[model samples]
Target: MRATVIRAPHDIRVEEVADAVVREPADAVVRVLRACICGSDLWAYRGESARQPGQRIGHEFLGVVEGTGADVTGFAPGDLVVAPFVWSDGTCEYCAEGLQTSCPRGGFWGSAGSDGGQGEAVRVPFADGTLVKLPADAASDDRLLTGLLALSDVLGTGHHAAVGAGVAPGSTVAVVGDGAVGLCGVLAARRLGADRIIALGRHTARTDIARLFGATDVVAARGEEAVAAVREMTGGHGAQAVIEAVGTEQSMRTAVGIARDGGAIGYVGVPHGSGTGLDLSVMFDRNIALRGGVAPVRAYIPELLPDVLDGTIDPSPVFDLAVPLGGVPGGYKAMDERTALKVLVTP
Candidate 1:
């Protein structure tokens, strides 16, 4: 089998690797049909995240089950399923409370000896708890396939940001950044019944998609100007909720600045940049509630899967380009250069 590996920052390669096989009774092997490059993956690509020289990479994927361990019963060979970026035992207390990302027995893909998602096949630990089976009649259309792929990470992460920000019916919501996750935040906000959605991004192409996903307005401004624009849009009160998708000091400041005094911020971006301090005084003075972390994608998949399958909300547009498994290095480059919104990898 061939898989993607990062030998160094900006150095991505697809090379032959050992075949995936069931190693635990709770595991399953999946023949990856589709995979994607995530913004978070760029952290390592840019040499920001710590990783070994020859580490396997990627974590968003869906595929057909090729085999399962004796203890796995929720699925069987030939079943189509989506693997959450993180694997967890569904029986854990945290999983019971919808916090699977924090499950004691849970771990992320491509970590702790798990095969990365961008590969021919991967060994899925806690298979029954981590894989979501698709309907037998799942659409073969590329759009539907792309949308299903989003459920594994971007869409679910966006939903988590919105929910954490306390977005509600009739609420005014603002999203920072225009990445795939940011655009998905716009979609998630609309689905949650937000009356107005303000999207902040400098790229016209991305902002256009944000609008299509339900952004009521696009602010191409930056820094204080961006903050002022969102504030003005909310009649000087700022947004009731703000979703910070960029995970940078500047993006976080923008999110906090554009949220009303009693509003909340849902930050999903993997925080990067120089070690920046959070202004507790400002948050305290404004009574702002800040919440977010690695999204528990498994918890949100069931809620968003129906929407994707029924075509009620298609997030497929995020994948502006698709390449074969062997072309994964270019896919990573395209994302790093911002030449592509998100790259889908077909294995």
Candidate 2:
């Protein structure tokens, strides 16, 4: 079998590796149909996140079950499913309370907890607890389900960002960054009932996608100018909710600086050190709420899965390019260099 590995920053290679197998009774082995590169993957690929030689990289996937343990009843070999980026033992205390990302038994592949998703097959532990069954029409739904795949992480990450920011009905929300996660934030904010949605992006292509996702306004400002534009859009009071989808310092600053007093900031951008100290006096005096971290995607998937099935929300547009596993390095480079908003890799 072959798996994707980041030999070093700016260098990704698809190397032959040992095959993955079902070693645990609670595990399921999946034959991946498509696995997309994520900004999070870029973190490790770019030397921003810690990783070792031969670490299997990749986390978002859409695939068919090749085998499952006896204890798993919700699925079988040949069934297509969407697994959340975070793999958790559903019976844990955190999982029971709807915080799968924090599950004590949860395993985040390609990261510290477990293996990764960029390969021929994946051994998903706690199969019954983590993978979601897609519609019976999964064959036809495959190509159209990229957004659902995105939901397994980025889309869900975006939704979590908006919710963390405290977006509400009739409130104006602003999003920083125009990447797949940020564009998805626009969609999530609208779904959460934000009436006026603003997206801050410098790229025309990305900003266009943001508008399509329900951004009522687009600000093509960079750095502090973007922050000022967001404030000006909300009548100088700033947005009631600001979603920070870019992990860089500039975008993080834009998210916090553009938020209104008493408002909230939801940040879910893989945190490449963008999270810093805010003016304590300003935040404390204004009563602003700050919330976000790794998104609890598994907890939110059940609610969002139906929306994808019913066609109410389509996140597939984020996948502007798709490639085979062997071409995954190009996929990573395209995304890291901003040549593509999101790249899908089929393994």
Candidate 3:
């Protein structure tokens, strides 16, 4: 089997590796049909996040079950499935509360000795709890494939931002950033019934998709200018909820500044930069509620899967570029260079 390995910053290679196989009774092996590079993956790609030489990378994928351990049930060979970026045991207390990302027995893909997602296959732990079965016909269509693949991570993360920010019917929401996750946030805010969606971004391509996904306004401004634009749209009151998708200091400040006093700010971007960390004094003074972390994607996957299958929400536009498995390095470069919003890989 071939898999992506991050040897160092700006160095991603697809090379032959040992095949993924089930090693525990609760595990299953999935033959990946589609995989993708996540914005979070760029942290290591840029060397901002530490990486070991030859470390397996990536964590968004959907595939067909090739084999399962004895203890795994409700899934079998040939079943089409999607695995959340994090693997969790459904029986845990945190999982019971719809917070699978915090499950004590859970861990992320490409870490803790698990196979990475951007590979031909993966050994999925907590098989019954982590893999969501899809209709066998689901993978046959290009649009559906893109949507389902989004469900594996980005869409679910965006949904988390909307939910975390307390988006509700007739609410005014602003999404910070125009990355795949940001665009997906626009879609999620609409699906959740937000009356007005403001997308803060500069890229025409991404902003275009944001509009298609349901952004009522696109503010191609940054910093205080962006903040003023959002407040102006809300009659000097800012949005009721703000989704911070970029995870940078400037983006976070923009999200906070554009959120109405006492409103919630849902952020899911992998935090980076020196000033990106939380500032308690600011939140305390404004009575702002900050909610979000690594998204509990498994919890939302089932909630959002029906919408994808029913044609109610299409997030496929995020994958603007596609490449073969061996061409993953180009995919990384495309994303890093801002030439592609997101890249999809096929085995």
Candidate 4:
């Protein structure tokens, strides 16, 4: 089998690796059918996140069951399923509270000694808890299949941002990024019945998708200028709910600046750099609430999956580029260069 490996900054390759197989009673080997790159992966690709040479990369995928260990019973060979980026034991206390990311025995894919999603197959741990069964008919529909794939990460993360920010009927919401997750945030706000969605981004191509996803306004500015634009649009009140999809000092500052007094900010972006751009004094003075972190996407899948299957929300448009397993290096380059929004990998 061949899988993607990070050799160094700006270098990704598809290399032969050991085959995936069930290694534990709770394990299952899945023949990957669809996989995609994530925005967070770029941190390591750009050398901002450390990785050993030859470390496996990628952590979102859906596939068909190939084999299952004796203890696994929820799925059988030929069952279609999706694996969250992280694997967790469904029986854990955190999982029961809908926080599977904190499951005691949970672990992320592509970590050392684990198989990556950007490969022909993967050996999934805690199989029944980690893999969600998908309808078999999804395999024959490319668009629907792609939408289902989004449930593995970005869509769920965006929904988590909306939930965290307390988006509700007739609420005014603002999203702070235009990447795939940000665009998905727009869709999520719409799904939650937000009447006004302000998307802050400079890229016209991405903002266009934001509009399609129900962004009522687009603020193509940065820093305080963007904050003023949003405030003015809201009659100097700012948005009631803000989704910070870009994990950066400046973006977080912008989110804080544009949130209305007593409003909430849901931050789903994976924080990077040395500073967090958070000011406790301002939040305290304004009575603003801060929520959200690494999204527990595994817990969101069940609630969001039905909408994806029913065509109520289509996240597939975020996947602007497609690549075969052999073309993964180019896929990474395209994403790093900002030429692609997201890359769909067909193994």
Task: State the C-alpha lDDT per candidate.
Answer: 0.91, 0.84, 0.92, 0.93
Specify the highest-TM-score model's number.
4
Per-residue CA lDDT of model 3 for 262-329, tens digit only, reads 89999999899888645678778888899987899999988999999999999999999999999899
TM-score: the better of candidates 3 and 4: 4
**Alpha-carbon runs more than 4 Å astray in model 3:** 277-279
Task: Write model 4 residue lDDT over 93-148, tens digit each, in one string.
Answer: 99999899999899888888898889999999999999999999999999999999
Candidate 1: tens digits of C-alpha lDDT, residues 1-347: 99998888999889898999999999999999899999999999999998888788999999999999999999999998998999999998999988999989998887847799999999999999889999866637667877899998999999999999999999999999899999999999999999999999999999999999999899999989999998888889999899999988998888888999999999899988885436779989999989988899899999999999998889999899999998899998999999999999999
Where does candidate 1 stray beyond 4 Å?
none
Pairs that collide, model 2: 110-115, 147-315
Q: List model 2 lDDT by residue over 92-209, tens digit each.
A: 8899988898888787777643557888888899998899887757556665667668768988899999999998899899998899999999989999899999988889988888
What TM-score fits each model?
A: 0.98, 0.96, 0.98, 0.99
Q: Which residue pairs does candidate 1 place in steric collision?
A: none
- Write down the TM-score for model 2: 0.96
Of 1 and 4, the candidate ahead on TM-score is: 4
The candidate, 1 or 3, that scores higher on lDDT is: 3
Report how far off residue 215 is in candidate 2 (Å): 0.5
Q: Over the full model, what C-alpha lDDT does candidate 4 score relative to the true structure?
A: 0.93
How badly does each model clash, as a count of residue pairs? 0, 2, 0, 0
